[model samples]
Target: MAELSAPTGREPGLRAVPRPDGTMPRALVIGATGYLGGRLVPRLLAAGYAVRVLARAPERVRAFQWGDDVEVVEGAAAEAAAVRRAVADVDVVYYLVHSMAAGTGFEEADRRAAQTVADAAAAAGVGRIVYLGGLHPDDVPLSPHLRSRVEVGQILLDSGVPTLVLQAGVVIGSGSASFEMVRHLTDVLPYMPAPRWVRNRIQPIAVRDVLHYLLGAARVDPAVNRAVDIGGPDVLRYGQMMNGYAVVAGLRQRAIAALPVLTPRLASHWVNLVTPIPRSIARPLVESLQNDCVVKDDDVDALIPPPAAGLTPYRRAVALALGRVEADDVETSWRDAELSGVPSDPLPSDPDWAGRAVFTDARSARTPAPPDRLWAVVEGIGGENGWYSSPVLWALRGWMDRIVGGVGLARGRRSRRRLAVGDALDFWRVEAVEPGRLLRLRAEMKVPGLAWLELRVAPEGTGARYDQRAVFFPQGLAGRLYWLAVLPFHGFIFRGMANRITAAAARAS
Candidate 1:
């Protein structure tokens, strides 16, 4: 029950540590920027642990509000230097980094990463290493994905670091791929001819509960170091899960017939053809599903106990997943084909905009100043600044929105310099604001479907490059027509807007 020593200088009680009554210990969470890692870091901090995190993209790590609260070390876990720096002076280490996103040879990459973590943890004199892996009964012939998962855990265990391996099935959460898959399948497909794996009995865990066990595992005595199977309340067949998801999503219960002829690879391809999720992610996921993934061990219950309340039933988890989709609360998705790096040469951009009989006129300008200076001018747009283009046209657009009861340009910024969540900027609501790098605004004005105006300023040469991207999400046939109708004048409007902003910034400078 030893407590982690607290670092000082900054805040009063914020910097104070609990008396090391041998109660709490320090934890270092690798992959702290990932979905599970993101959730776990805050939980550990709340549990009174001086948590440190090692992230490949430290900027992304710093962007999270938790970055200020925890020590952020920027580097990959495979890098010995970064691992040594991260693992030093930590009681327990959480190895959560995986190369699943690295395309092929994911198994080999995972093995090397596990070894790196184990070696680094041992060198730094870490007490325990807690690893979260996928669930698959050891008796069954494991798929490559599940095999890699178990092998990684084995490597960690063999590292001579007292390791607690938690084997979990599909995690149901907002950002989780498994949950999103269930949601998408149910939402997009009313009827499905599924593969034989549809009969596979899988016990899916909620992300909240997975996090609970992980945090609990970190605090458990180093003496308890063994792989434990973890799952949710229900052990339902994959087909049943689909039915449950459809019900929760307010969709008609779809009929799924298991076909023996449909192989996992073929099933994966089928999924890619229908759902937004790509084959690269879908194939591995579908392949893993061929094996029954129900929990075999009940040891985790003794350690962490059942999650308190609001434990999402399979139905409720599906409901939440669908709810997230409706609310546009997506954090990341396998549908993000851009980052996948799939070969196609001139990789097409967001198809939501392209192939449409619409107009998209984009304009960029260069300014002789830091990105911050350029962004300052861009941010000061709309309202009193009058959009830096045609004041009369901006007013007319506002008038049109007013006729339709939309927010229009009436909603101005809360403050000139400071911006917070949900703040308004003329006809747009600030969707996201990344200080000097990006400022994205969602148009609240009446549009065809969804519309956004994003201004990105990146430092280039001696100055900054200002790029303005105007995105329009059309609804149906009428939306397409509206876009096409306005296509001709977009060139003039967008170009004028971009140049004026640059000119305004130049004058201010």
Candidate 2:
């Protein structure tokens, strides 16, 4: 891969991806909306890369916190005109796109996409190309997913441009398909059956370390134009990984059975039933476990130095992923209590908040009441005062949460008419409050993801405008499904709450 010197005036004692001319490197990311691509773009920007993204739907890219930070070139990678436009004048290309979710003939689709990107990058004379692939044994027959990845990396390497293909296995992070699989399987079933591959060894790496190598790949020696193995320390069998997660999450050790009869397809179906991951994606991920996935050589280390803190161990990565829920950092992820700005102001406010799929619902109404009357109603919400909506729906949700061992609505608020940031209001925590303006509550109920409710009031035309928003960041597939199931109720819950609050305020005026 081509080497670029670090930008001038960099923080001392820190290595920056280098560009010889001391100018910012322009990078084109093909899968800028995926988990890896979403995380990589901001880091590339921090590392001094002028980023440009290629996507079929520009709105998806615009949804990212860094959406406005980079130039968006709209088009599918399969389209030559689109890929050509994205690659032009770009220094490096990050091929993080994979269509395993497309299912059935996803391999061919991946191949065509790779060929399109490779040709486009070569034609543009892109400085370097980086692609993340799976780590598998050399002698055995690779799974269809792994084979497709290998083929894609080879295509990029042979495109007449220097390419650095970093192969990793079982990335452990929140919302990651693999990590979510491990999480949900442990959380749902105390004893998991079947899947003889559970005994297979795996060298799972943390998402942070994966991103680390990706950033470092920018400075790999120009002659280094081949795939390298990247993994974390402490390799263990798949079952042991689950037990390790159990330890970190304060759960009992799980009983995992590796029965020979459980084929990959059957195992995937089982995983689909238990975890948030769907069968389509779970099949390939499960099939990958058919063989051990340990890194064979230290080729990656020879090119890019490991993180100074060293690779994150398996248990440590699990703890990092679970720490958010344990500490209620999900509430802190909102970035502030005032409910100012958009939902994704800094994209992810913290590393802990990364990898989640965010969903939101918002509504507004105008009331004849002044801002103070509206604020009074907003602040006096929850507790015995009720939510100014369907009490039956709220109570039913609360009862369900209680059944799941969550802190149910019985907690109520500290006061009937006032609140502070740390007060517990029923199944919610008062996160932030702006007197006569806004009140934001973080949901403490047991759900598959993090949720928040925001109430706002502003004076307008001798009246007041009341706005309400419900936001959620789903953990994984389960979380997505949970949101979908409740979406129909949102019109009744949040919309009714907004309207009722406005009506109450108008009557009080």
Listed in order, each prediction's TM-score against the native is 0.67, 0.67
Q: Please, what are the lDDT tens digits per residue for candidate 2 over residues 378-404?
A: 989986789888899998997776554
TM-score of 2: 0.67
lDDT of 1 by residue, 85-129 (tens): 989888889887654445667787788778888998888889889
Name the TM-score of candidate 1. Answer: 0.67
Residue-level lDDT for 384 in candidate 2: 73
Q: Which candidate is the best by lDDT?
A: 2
* Off by more than 4 A, model 1: 1-24, 324-433, 436-454, 457-509
State residue 360's C-alpha deviation in candidate 1, in Å. Answer: 16
Model 2 residue-pair collision total: 7
The true-structure Cα RMSD of candidate 2 reads 11.4
- In terms of lDDT, the poorest run of 10 residues in model 1 is 1-10
Q: How much does each candidate deviate from the true structure in C-alpha RMSD?
A: 12.6, 11.4
**Candidate 2 lDDT (Cα, whole model)?**
0.76
